[model samples]
Target: GGEGGPNAGGERERRRGGRKDESDWWTRFQNDFPWDEKTTRNVVIGFAGMASAFLYFYFRETGKEVSWKDFVNNYLARGLVDRLEVVNKQYVRVIPVHGSYLWFNIGSVETFERNLELAQQEMGLDSTHRVPVIYGSKSDGTFLMSILPTLLLVGSLLFTMRQGPMAGGRGGGRGNPFSMGESKAKIMKDNIDVRFKDVAGCEEAKLEILEFVNFLKNPRQYQDLGAKIPKGAVLSGPPGTGKTLLAKATAGEANVPFITVNGSEFQEMFVGVGPARVRDMFAMARKNAPCILFIDEIDAVGRKRGRGNFGGQSEQENTLNQLLVEMDGFNTSTNVVVLAGTNRPDILDPALMRPGRFDRQIYIGPPDIKGRASIFKVHLRPLKLDSSIDSEALARKLAALTPGFTGADIANVCNEAALIAARYLNESIIVKHFEQAIERVIGGLEKKTQVLQAVEKTTVAYHEAGHAVVGWYLEHADPLLKVSIIPRGKGLGYAQYLPKEQHLFTREQLFDRMCMMLGGRVAEQVFFGKITTGAQDDLRKVTQSAYAQVVQFGMSEVVGQVSFELPRQGEMVMEKPYSEPTAQLIDQEVRSLIDAAFQRTHQLITEKRDVVEKVGRRLLEKEVLDKADILELLGPRPYEEKSTYEEFVEGTGAMEEDTSFPEGLRNWNKDQGMEESPQEQQRKQCLNTVSHA
Candidate 1:
């Protein structure tokens, strides 16, 4: 019994080993056929088509094996044929004596009957041994043959449908014939980590949106007071002003899910697809209630509806109508808050910007001096700096340099500065790196290696000096910050100025600016005795300014306050908004303005010839001069203009309360003098020329 127990245990172990081998083999088989459900279905369909094709060819070929003469002579004569079937009376199948049936074609039922009887009688076969005749419908086989291609086509469509809309080819979502009008908006159930602190600048805009976030957080408080939380808010601003970032920050502040999409994504080339997508997007928003739906660049699909001229634009209009219904439709209680951003609000449909639809239109312009400083602070947080670098001073200087820079431009400047520092293998960023970054942003990189003839260099120096002198003399012109004779960007020479952040411009100021623009060309003619093509951009700007003052700004004497500017069009046509007489008058006015500006610039250069020559010689020697250097050569003017950044801190009284900055750096010291002793005498001569002007 003990021996029997041992044998049984061994046998059990063997059986278990066999089962393990089977399991391993099964797993290997599954691994070899590793495909997704869609791929597997396609493979099965392909194999089915191949099998059906093979069967069709096999049956078709086998039917033609025995000829009519051979069937009668070989099989029928020997009485080997047991039975005959006439299928649709076009083909006859003969049962063989020892194998499967054989088939032959005949003309018709009568012919087949006659032939079979003749063959049977010729063989002298009796009724029992004769091949019995039976008729078959053959309609089922014909039906399958006719429907095989349709079944394969339907199977192919099913395979394509299993794949997503992206696989629908180049047309993408809307181009695909099989798409079900699904929403293209991407859903983010998780809260975005960006907070309001991450978005710098646009403080007022932020404050406006903060209330909306609070409403989302504590809706019951507002609801109890019968105050409906705003259904929507539109963040209208120029590009790169942080509209999308504000939306993300708002989502983070409210701690709600975010569904973001572009307005263009809702439109497509197909009919009804755009509207369907709008409905689907709204349906998704409703399902994910208490969430934020942010649509970026809404102007793409929400332009004035009927203004679109193309056949496909009707689809976009349909989408806009659907969007309007979704935003402020009858389902008012839905918790989804819509946030749209656009750069061109003027192009939007009037109905789309109605009160209930976009309850608040938050305009986010470029940051002010104070706002820019805050933005710099936010961006500079991650950079490593030298101990000598003062962040406050650097921020103030950067804000001054970038008066019209958006948040994105500020970030780019910071990044460029870092890159410049890294290129020199420096451990920390310094003031010079930031200065280079500012130059790169405004005037582009310095082409130090570009060779210039001595005459050309002298001409450039005089040209830039001409601008400085004119700007220095004109009370309304911007103050000259720096002058450079070295080539940068497309210009052979350039002058940097500190333009005030003023919204309105007077006619005097416009005239003074135009004179400043013509300074270079006038100087070129005076110093070189001829003009060059270097002032092409300067001329272009002057022309535009003159035309704007005459035609667009309505600053002309004869044109009155009415603007004669033509309507904006995508195509070019030889048509003027005014009649021939008015057009001639406008042209004459523009030319008169340019000529007057040039004469004033020429006169100023002629009177200040001494200062121009002195400054031009210095620029030729140094190649570049900053504010202190320029002031050293030209002396103090009667008027001193401050940058917007300086005025902002001074007006707000924040300059006095700041403890981080050292005392001497608080204000611009006018005491810095040139190394030469003759600077004082030259300064007196410069003051005399400015007073005379």
Candidate 2:
């Protein structure tokens, strides 16, 4: 029949149409419901109200519980009852006319009604005066409320897993937690406050780093000339020598993005996290093309591969490997310049220091007198100073005072000067405040609260006086600056010398320094007839100097002229290069040199015994003495030494009429209560006990 004719075909079509599958409930509902704004608004409102109701039921507190007897006495007998409600027939709630509501346990609806009616009748209440009763079941949402916390907890767990490092983008790993491999580099959009002018001491380093900025700002110019941009630069120096400052200045002078990360950030408790982070960091730098990436203290991860892998810490090696690959892989056109800073550059991997990787190595040593003078000028602009203070002369004098000071040290000096002035309630910092600050920075904080016995005080005085006498008379010794018996830092006495700014030292010079270092012990032995532990530090310094002269400096005649690179402090080398016999020879040389210096020192102390006694008595009377006081006691320094203040005062003819130093800079904000930069703070923190060596 279906295959026959037009009627059959039509019937088949009609049957198929009638038997066609209907839409699902949701589709039909959507099709049937009104699609206007009002309907949409009503649906949203419905959902919101449902959610609100659920929350209200979950958190709202019901009426306070009360005993049936109390409820009747408080409300029903007082004629204060408003209404009664029975919830799920398990409890009865009492509502008052002018106070809070109360609820109580009930036996049953029938029993409660009978008891209520009896109570009302016994109280002689009329029908109109009886409290009304209402009945209702508790909201079903209570069951959902009970399970809501569990549902929320499950949802949050799912969300966290979805967002954790295990599920995150790019660097995600299956067993990792949230963002363990995320780049911790700080990114700045050319918002740095440090500039080339802000840095004064590292002129060479700054000039070299500025080349990177030029390459970043004008990449095409370098490329068109067939020049390849440097892949990276390493700024190596002692602590607080402006390695970080030079990097900052490079970033500040450039218009490109600056990204900085500590080398330690690459390391993680997880094995592969360091390499993963290195990958992510490079990815970030590439994403923000024409950017500079700086890693400070890179030696933390860049140590030489084979030597210091003790305890199976191969993570640092893996990180360093990734760093090398990324640094070498940067495209010349990427305009991404990499910079690293480390005080222990000698310990870094040879591959990391290769030309194709780091490309350049800039060593920034401590500033000399001229460089220190400029650094002082930069730090001095912010301090409130006295009217008679000449900025130029002050810079020169401070430079001479701090012979080996880095830029960081000078900043510390200016800051300390201001603090000292404020401590004394002075309106402005004066020259004396600056002098005291220098002493504090060099000799450590003075501890006047430390009281010494009469014998100990006398010992300290003679000990300091012995140092002064030896240094004053020795032709090769540094000029004596000040000697004080007041306890300071961990020492019972302090003596400061104006160490001359010189690079090379002859044998006589080193021998004289050793003698000077041994002067205190010699003086103690001669006068007290017994050696005390007062010269323990001096002995250590003298011993170190003796070894350095013999082994490192090739100053020992027996050890010959060949300087051996001995193991330095903090190095983990357990084996010496030379044989045991050679080691014995080195030890003998060191002992012979020290004994000679000790004998020389003893002879000087005996010859100047009167001078030492005179100085010690004076020190006990005053507790402090300057060069002038020493000169008054002992005739004069027999040796010819250059004056520290001469260069600062010469060739400057006349003083400027302007008495005040100009305000430093608008960008150096004083409103937020910042007195110094982070570099200065870091330098201040790096200050340690003064090392005589």
Candidate 3:
């Protein structure tokens, strides 16, 4: 009757649902919840229900009625109720309490919350019903969304710390360590302690460098007067002649920045790197204006390009190009000057030596006598030398001994002297020490203890005595200093001479010296009755001297005034400097000249046979002989004898004997005054009687 009152409807519903139907409905409801896909949904729903129930009870006890309609509008829609919105027919909203809610389509939580917030704000709902925003959480329920970005940022920071400034916040690259790559052309000031005074034996080079230094200091003085300073100067010489040292001294005197680098350092495996480095070097030099860029051994890079087949792809060629550009090309100015040093100027490219590039080429040759003496003084300044040590005499001796020695050799000789003195525990270096040093430098050490057979000893002694006796008789020969039978270095014996201070030689002098060289073999022939190979060095010397006389000095009458300055390659030819017929003539002449010299030597030795035997025997016993021993055996020279022509010519033969005549003279009559002696008067009367007859 009233649609069967509420209690009657409930009884009818229960009567229609049996136990099996109830269980089926419960299973169907659980299946509709999508528990696998949304496992936490049921838990969340149960918690929300319990929390709402507690709040409702608490509010109701406080005299606030929990209206069903109000709850549906506020708690259900906003607080206590839940509905699923579906886009079927007209956006149907079904309550979650019924199983029919399973058919409703639901938007994602983010979309739903966004729409609900919009609607609630539009309707001006209470602030307590509004949803809160999570910073990193999105519709997918992911958390800590900034973790990847934070990790990337930290990694970038660490990379920047490791890489330094030049690299773009990345580790491990070719970055300069000290930020010194961009520095201007500057030398290490601490190591630039080398002053001009420290350099030795290159006075000419030093003077030239001093002018450059002055120009660097006052460039305006020349510039104002319409004069241009040399852009560069090339120092050319043999090695160890102080070319590089002069350049450094110039830098020091100028007191400007010095950029020093070897020419080889510019070349690299990468072809373009050389040019790039050259550009960089020049850029630095330009920035440090009024500076010197010293390139040592410049021939390494500045060789004559395109002359040799070194493969067209040469870094040295590229470097040379860059150097040319930097030296005289578009960017060249007077501010930067180039200084190049090399021993081989002949091989250098002409471009490098042209007027604008290297305007001056200074030659630093081996030191002369004065320069050598000065060099010795400079080197000996630090050593303990006796006051009596004559640097000039030492220099003269060294100059003679070292024909092609540079300043560096003199320094080495000084160092060797010091070492010799040290070995002897000498407080100061004396003349003897320097002598030993010279011998060590020139002929190597003496092997005095070397054992030789009696025959070998005799041969050595005769050989050395031959040299001494021949040198004594030959007018133009160098004075004998020592003759030794002792083995030294490669020689079984040796004869040392006090070489004259003359650099030029006359033909007579050369011939006389050659004769002296031949004297050894002559002596061997005269004494031993046969020649041994002990005269190998003498033969070589004599042959060379004879050839020089014939070809170089034009001393041979057969090859009159003919000079054969043979090329270095043509030195080995047998019939050199003349036609075949002329060669025959030259050979004959050379043989005749050598034969006559040997004959003269043989005759002299025969005349002074006893003296020669005595000197040779003494040399064999003692292994060495000074000039005094040689003079004692050979007796006084004819020049030292004071006998007049008249005394000997008249047959008076008054034997003049004056031991105390003078330091130089050997023969004189003590009783004979400025007034003629009785024997001299008798000799003059006999000469008059002979003239009268």
Per-candidate clashes, comma-separated? 0, 0, 5
For model 3, the superposed segments whose C-alpha errors exceed 4 Å read 1-186, 267-277, 305-318, 330-332, 386-405, 549-608, 635-693
Model 1 agreement with the true structure over 263-351: per-residue lDDT tens digits: 98876665666777777777777877878889999999889976636655487787898889878673446777889999999899999
lDDT score of model 1? 0.79
> Which segments of candidate 2 are over 4 A away from where they belong?
1-177, 307-313, 645-693
Model 1: residues >4 Å from true position, as ranges? 1-180, 310-313, 330-332, 564-577, 652-693
lDDT scores for all predictions?
Answer: 0.79, 0.81, 0.66
TM-score of 3: 0.59
Query: In model 3, where is the ten-residue run with the lowest total lDDT?
Result: 659-668
**Better model by lDDT: candidate 1 vs candidate 3:** 1
Residue pairs with clashing backbones, model 2: none
lDDT of 2 by residue, 1-693 (tens): 457876997888888776663445556777888475345445755775687686876755476988888887877899888899898888887878887888899988999999999999999999988899999877636677778667656755554444343332474432333456676778888668987778887766766776677667656657888999888999999999999888888778677889999989887776666887788788889989989999999998899897746778588888888888888787787788899999998889899999888999999999777778788888998888899999888987888888888877788989999999999899998899988999898888999988899999999899899899998889999888889999878888998888877789998999999999988999998999988998999999998888888888887778788777867778677788788998999999888888888898898899989989999999999999998998899987777776665644345453221211123221222332436656555665667433322
CA shift of 49, model 1, Å: 5.9
Candidate 1: lDDT of 162? Answer: 41
On the 0 to 100 scale, the lDDT of residue 474 in model 1 is: 91
Q: Which stretch of 10 consecutive residues in model 1 shows the poorest summed lDDT?
A: 665-674
Of models 2 and 3, which has the larger lDDT? 2
